[model samples]
Target: MTLQLERDAVLRRHIGPVALAAAVINGVVGAGIFTLPAAMARAAGAWAPLSYLVCAIAMSFVVVCFAEAGSRLPTSGGVYGTVAFAFGPAAGFVCGMLTWMASVLACGGIAGALADTVGTVLPGIAAGPGRALVIIVSIGAIAFVNMRGVREAAWMVTAATLVKLVPLLLFVAVGAVMVLSGSVPPPRPITAPHVFGLATAVLLGVFAFSGMETPLAASGEVANGNRTVPRALFGAMGFVLVLYVAIQLVAQSLLGASLGGQAAPLAAAAARIGPVARMLLVVGAALSMLGWIGSDILGAPRILFAFARDGLLPRVLGRAHRRTHAPDAAIVVHAVIAAGLALSGSFTGLVVASTLNTAGLYFLGCGAAWVLHRRRIQTVGEPVDFRLLPVAAAGGMVAMAVLIYVAPPAEILGLVGVLAASIALYGIMRGIGGRARPPVG
Candidate 1:
């Protein structure tokens, strides 16, 4: 009975094409609208837009792997779920744990970023118990909204996604107007860098497209899970790539060398237009942060739910909310973990550490995809209609490995610790349950 329990989840088919597309958009167009421009400007200089193009091109392979593998498996475990179905319980547990830990860390970073910025618009948000209250309240609201159902959750995500994109679109359009008229100054030559520097910058830029696989999470909820997952993956990746490049082109083209030095790169670009544009960009930044917070609160907990259902985590987390049909327990667990990190003063460290951990997990996912692809011939029936998924997955693995090396040392160590800890936790869980014990779902 216990062994059978893990395989007994009901497939609801609540999400449709719109929901999947919106989730893709939500996953891709995150807080980076405000934060990434500055980082890209610093790392790649005048050719930051070029970095956007390169990164987009590189992520194609990763996107394809995720799409194909997710469609074929159609499991709630996501990357780990696919791996677990393909491999075994032990592999699944580690993959699930690492993915969940990465999600929690990333959510904390997004929340921290929002908290600091909330200080700008609402002055009292940064100090005393006031700040903690705001963080807890904000996250709790998102949690309640998500606890409703995936269909409703997807609607919420879609709305937030549109709100985030509006500001970026305005910034790009406004910058173009400034440049077209004689109002903006002309761009000057930005001396190019060595090949290695350029390549390294491009790798991190590609990493910007990191979470594009998120629509895969909707696989369980999606109508025709086998069909919708791949389509949404491609659509989301293309949309974000276009947005990133367009924003970079308008901003860097108009501001040139000046783009790199500003506290708020988009706002600074807007300043070239006039004070109004600057104000709009600031408001947009706030919206972008809010959108990111919303996306994290919605997406991260799903991965944890996947973990818990696989017997890698406490059984309580695997139980769905009977009324809402949502993964309420996993949502609450991750929210608490992330909220604690957000209230602490280590936002920068968490962001760095999370990115590193994410890189490691990504590599594992890619490798698992590769394994599944190579062994496809062994499966019954028409080869399971396997594609060049292994090749695409291998490319993704290589890309993430390169990014890991380029990341800061502290980040590298933090990720190493996360992986090691996840592995140890898995062993402890297995021992407590003992052999022949059925996996929980």
Candidate 2:
């Protein structure tokens, strides 16, 4: 059934620039950044900061490529929509589902992290059944806020984004002051930078900053989409990238050798800021994870909704909530799947397994850019940011290659399974499509 959802549902313009920025910011500062610096330090030794810089440079390519595609096509499902149009419905469905699963699992990870952070501060509160219950409650509340629709969710994210940013700012500012004044504790200088280790360190750094392209996933929901999508993609990512590097630099300077082993890098840096600020880091880390969860709640369902709308899955899930205008069923599916994985302690394993499919979609997006450019030529219309896209495409190719070689094998395996399921689903869809008649009574 080619279910025709309200044009309002399919072509909604519920987002503005502020909401867009929060979504972008929300995507970037999740649990990865909270813990990655220490591991990166271990990998690169003193050169870890430089490693983060490398990842940032690599990500610029993804942002640029995604921006070009987002502005031109302006659809939900981020890379999935771009790939589908470039290829076919089945390709798009597979791509969308992969991305949806990734975002959902990522959210669960953030929920787990947020709960852990809570324990760090309110030791008793974060333990056992109490902490687990809090995680569920926090996730459920945030998910509900997101389901309330764009305007409401955007406001909450914006506030939460600000809440998360404060501690990061203090980390950088206070670290600098401590070093300049000679108050930073005397420590060993693993300070010397190593190139190869730095590269690996920065790959993890890039993971922290990877949320920028997410705005493209909900392109269909933004007002003045063609213009707004690029603005949000480039503007939000560029700002966040700078802030992330700044945060790391500040953190390293403040904590020195001692900092290299910290689980909560910002919190460690905060200790240098003074005892008062240490408490704030826990608040900020918790907020950052919550922000990530909120963005996941907002973005993932759209991909599933896209899949259902296109007849690749059950059409019942294609329906939008009559009042809220949200994809109610898709939201339920995402929440349930993420929760299942979370309770099973399987989110990390899934990340390992889904890496291949995620990387596959990046190449698929680059291929779409090529196809879109060619189609534009055949029609003889003005080229759609044709000049800038090649750079993004090339960057995506390099990034995907690196991720495939470097990402855990289990992630690649999980991706293979998802792809296989998609192929099977496509065959079933094709059979259904063939037997279908023209739309009639």
Q: Per-residue CA lDDT of candidate 2, range 262-365, in tens?
A: 65667767776788888888777777777767767777777677666766668877888788898878877887777666555532343433334556666677
Question: Clash totals for all models, in order?
Answer: 0, 8
Which regions of candidate 2 are displaced past 4 Å? 1-22, 125-130, 144-155, 190-203, 221-228, 319-326, 343-357, 377-388, 430-441
Pull out the clashing pairs in model 2: 51-198, 51-202, 52-202, 78-217, 352-410, 352-411, 353-410, 353-411
- Displacement of the residue 117 alpha carbon in candidate 2, Å: 0.8
Query: What Cα-based lDDT does every candidate model obtain?
Result: 0.67, 0.66
What digit string (tens of lDDT, one per residue) describes model 1 on residues 314-414? Answer: 78888899998888898888788888988884444565566566666677777766765666522111223346676777787887787778777766777
Best candidate according to TM-score: 2
